[model samples]
Target chain A: MKTKKSLLFISYEEARHICDKIQYGEATRMEQIKLFIRISWCNISRKYTQKNTQLTTLCQSANLKSLDKDKKDSLKKMLESKMSESKD
Target chain B: MSSNTLDPTQWIDKYADYLYNYSVSRVSDNEIAQDLVQETFLAALKSSENYKGDASERTWLISILKRKIIDYYRKINSKKGKAEVRMSYNSDGDGDGDWMEERISDPHGNNAEEKIQNTELGLAIHECISKLPPKQAKIFSMKTIEGYETETICNELDITPSNLWVIIHRARTALTACLEENWF
Candidate 1:
């Protein structure tokens, strides 16, 4: 049981590091279990784990669309002129 | 003659939206994304003579855009007020230990309300990152947003793994506290 206990239990600081590694897909299964066990009792670490996951997900889906037609046109015209100037 | 010399004017109609979306995702600023996309086109024109047509026009434009984005981060890092911004964060006593004040339960992450909240939090998170010391911000985004491997980041940024971890932990702590203030 000594091995099991050491494998599952970890300090908060260690738990946080494992949590980050888990998110980054760098943690081993043993480390992931340790982090899960730690977060079960550690509210702060649990929140941190949740927030970190949310932040990454948000960023991946942060595809903000550009809808400024006028700006697009002006930029196009400016680029065209610049290109022509370079040619001449 | 080879048809390799792609016309510059066609880029706007063909790739502006794609390029703009890419830039905004990286930089998280609409105005700056627009400017960068435009700049990408200009760079393409300046280097037009180098178009050997081995790559597609879109591919060439994207290469130019990627360089522009790197330059944008470098420019921000070299800006004058970087030290002032870093000093604004409380770096005196216990490092980021003070940021661990309170923690709430995990919110349900996939419901409609949560999705809406994420949209708002996306902007807030970007703002939080921008407020960090420019170096921390750059490294954090490179790690998280760009998903660079740890060794690659350490080597490219010329930082040790421990140094990278410290910066990331601090950045995450500050961002958590900031998002809680603004969103939670």
Candidate 2:
């Protein structure tokens, strides 16, 4: 009884977190298997996993890019100076 | 009911990715896009008084950025012997963004049609991301859009791996729900 309960004990939040890790290619094989088992029985987990994968695929296709930290830092400094100059 | 506020200190942190994506879609040049984002911030600061708290700051910044992009083209047009044809897009016209986008070739293995669609889809994704709570938006952009390593994000944000994962999960839930109406 204890073993069975332990096997099925994963919370939905935990399962969803694992889903996120899997999407990012960060989940370990053991973690992957745990998620696989959870999704096998939990309809909510399965649905979330599907939507999560679809979201990743869509973002991947979108080819989004981020402004790096160095540029962002420079922009911030520029804005600071401009703000001060405007006030003066 | 409109209740939005502007905070310049938070601008770079919150809206930089959003504006970067916005400008990249229009300009199609990475360095130029980053410069435009910077200019957008400076311009917004100069005209900060014009913001009446009605529109969200992101919307207002985007509006300003749109004008700046147009001006960028005008500047280039005059520099190139003033004979360069200025391309304009009819937002509602059937021909698509005929003038500008039709000219720039995408080097990222995307054909023109796919590039245009991806731009729209990218903007839509950013729009949904912009609606997330600030931390979640930042985390999602860094991890997913920026493609930062998990450890790097954890170190920068001072979050544990599990904390980041929780935030990612919540952000994904919101993003998926948001995107489902227009995309799936």
Candidate 3:
């Protein structure tokens, strides 16, 4: 049985590092457990995780506008012409 | 059905908006997005013979566009000199990752505040990413924004997993600092 004294409480640096590994799915099971234990009580690390999640979601959902019709038509003409040139 | 094959001419009208939106979201540059979509069309035409009709034309085009975007990142990074990836920690020499503590705080707010904040938050994030040193920006985008797997990123950028972790850590910390200065 793992003794309470032997259950290593990680440092802030280690906890953040493991949090990153967890984000990338790179942490080992034991590392994940340690990270979870750390974040459960560590408000700072929990905030880090929340910010990381927010950043990832913001990036994934970045709403970018599309080209207008006139621009699309011109680009299509250019590409089609280039296609024909390459074919010949 | 008048035709069994997808008409190539109709691709722009049918899929240009989709391709543009996808490209712009990833790259966040209108000209590059337009160029990438055009390149996708050209590549599709070049590889038209490879189309077996198993996937719809739109799917095939998207696949090509995705590859094009990856290639664009690879090509741009290739032109810069290959520097060894190094860890950027606090200059105080503690290596504790404590440099970010002063700069970042909880950005959370009431729902109305969040709604008002998120628009500029998006622009701030993009601006902060663009401010990273070129290689870090590229690697960060590939790993975080583009969602490339870690191993693939390591192989493509010729860095180890540990090195990537350090770079990503630095990038995120830098972004937090930037966001604090600009957004918060």
Candidate 4:
């Protein structure tokens, strides 16, 4: 009779074969899930970085366009106030 | 970001489909899988500074995504506090008890050879992996499916070497048992 450990080891090899199928996209649901996650990640990351860059550019441009030093200072002060409020 | 910067965009084209398919295999939900992928990308972008180029960009991005998925489950489970309740399969209109019975059926019997042939063994294995305990399943997928090294897996999971091995061993054992009973 085969030892229990040997039986388990054989079973593990079988399981690994099944997993190999999944890794290779031979599995249906597994393939779908992997595809969905990848697309979602790409979409989200691209959008987030794009949005952040746009916001940063807008901030910079607004700051640069301000001719009045007093207005620029006030804008900085407002940003500081908002930052402090967020901390609170 | 500078226009001259090498866009990781090329990486997305090559790895996005593969990665998304991998995530979807684990989560079994399209929307959530998509969200996880997006989170992975956003993480890569934010932490692009920390990526030391030791691993391929694909590997690094996947590591981040895996962490995000774990965090999501942790948050959800904390609020639910009822693991048993979530274990059942009710949302698909199939009774949980019946589903469990089906899940436990052997697919590789002499008469069931056709079923095994028609139904891809890989898909069956994917389902079996999905049924594993949450942490074990994640660890197994990261190691077995994603091909991450033990050291990287431990670091990403914040687990000790022993803990990682234990989880992997258990996960493999459980999957094997489940497959033997249900498929082979």
Task: State which candidate has the highest lDDT.
Answer: 2
The list of candidate 3 runs beyond 4 A from truth reads: A1-8, A63-88, B1-32, B36-121
Which candidate number has the best DockQ? Answer: 2
Query: How well does candidate 1 match the true structure in TM-score terms?
Result: 0.49
What's each prediction's TM-score? 0.49, 0.82, 0.46, 0.33
**Candidate order by TM-score, highest to lowest?**
2, 1, 3, 4
lDDT of 2 by residue, B136-184 (tens): 9989888897789989999998999878888887898899989997665
Q: Of models 3 and 4, which has the larger TM-score?
A: 3
Off by over 4 Å in 4: A1-88, B1-6, B82-103, B106-184
Q: Label model 2 with its docking quality class.
A: medium
The CAPRI class of candidate 3 is incorrect
Which 10-residue window in model 1 chain B sums to the lowest lDDT?
B98-107
Backbone clashes, each candidate: 0, 0, 0, 16
What does the lDDT read for residue A80 in candidate 4? 47
Q: Write the per-residue lDDT of candidate 1 for residues B80-103, one digit (tens) a residue.
A: 546665425556666665444413
Candidate 1: which stretches are off by over 4 Å?
A: A1-4, A63-88, B1-121
The DockQ for candidate 3, computed on C-alphas, is 0.15
For model 3, how does the per-residue alpha-carbon lDDT over A14-63 read when each residue is reduced to its tens digit?
A: 88788777766778998878878888999998888877766556654444
Give lDDT for model 4: 0.54
Query: What is the descending lDDT order?
Result: 2, 1, 3, 4
Error of 4 at A9 (Å): 54
lDDT of 4 by residue, B1-184 (tens): 3222223534343344345555665576766766676666656665667767677655676788789889878888897886556454555765545775677777665645643342344444555655677678667666655557778888977999668767765765676667667665
Q: Which pairs clash in the backbone of model 3?
A: none
Candidate 2: residue pairs that collide: none
